[model samples]
Target: MEGLDPRAFVLGCSAIGAGLAMIAGIGPGIGQGFAAGKGAEAVGRQPEARGTITSTMLLGCAVAESTGIYGLVVAMILLFANPLVGKIAG
Candidate 1:
């Protein structure tokens, strides 16, 4: 890496970091899906409680989705406004 440009290296590493940050989305997705499925099952078992179950499920899903949204925001920042790239003394 003797001839490697620092700015280019930082940019490349930021891209990789952005990709890894995106991986954080998978857990939230899976959790939200599972919560929805269980919520549906719960509502099916007690139709009268559908309103409560639905509302609770939606809230949980929203909370779970926030993590994925955060990951997406981090990835976007890394890709678009990468602070590390500016730190390189080019």
Candidate 2:
């Protein structure tokens, strides 16, 4: 750390943060998979309710997917439009 440039420090930290942010995508993937599996089970149990089950599952998946999208956006910002880099005056 003694000889590290301020800008280099900021850029390195931003890269780490962006990597961490990308991990957030995992949760939504798991949730959507679980939802789909459950939806399939529900439809199997009640074929007449297939439409309702599928629609609800899709809606839930869409909502869950937003978190992943947000995480992606944040990661992209951290990697490309990093504000912290600008904050480091030198």
Candidate 3:
């Protein structure tokens, strides 16, 4: 058989890019888990400070969410912008 068609090649690159983008999820998962554990420990130590601990935990989690957002942006770029297509076309 002949080599892949242009569309097929673009699709293959998109698939690879999607996989790479998903890998970024790992960072947020680990970071959020750590933040959750710390929040629990803090609440356990000072029951009266539960509110503060919860707020801080949520803030940290929100920060961790940024990594996932980055991943989504990358995936979107891969699916939409698809820089590799330009190279292939050239």
Task: Point to the candidate with the largest TM-score.
Answer: 1
Candidate 1 per-residue lDDT, tens place, 1-90, comes to: 799998888888899999999999899989999999999899889999999999999999999999899999999999998988778774
Candidate 1 — which residues are off by over 4 angstroms?
A: none
Q: How are the candidates ranked when ordered by lDDT, highest leading? A: 2, 1, 3
What TM-score does prediction 2 earn?
0.87
Q: Can you tell me which runs of candidate 2 are displaced by over 4 Å?
A: none
* lDDT by residue for model 2 (10-89), tens: 89889999999999999999999999999989998999999889999999999999999999999999998998877876
Clashes of each: 0, 0, 0
C-alpha TM-score for every candidate: 0.90, 0.87, 0.83
Q: Name the top lDDT candidate.
A: 2
User: Model 3 Cα displacement at 68 (Å)?
Assistant: 1.8
TM-score rank, highest first?
A: 1, 2, 3
In the order shown, what is each candidate's alpha-carbon RMSD? 1.2, 1.4, 2.0
The all-Cα superposition gives candidate 2 an RMSD in Å to the true structure of: 1.4
| Better candidate by lDDT, 1 or 2 | 2
| lDDT digits (tens) for residues 1-90 of candidate 3 | 277598777878798988899899999999999999999998889999999899989998999899899998989888878887777653
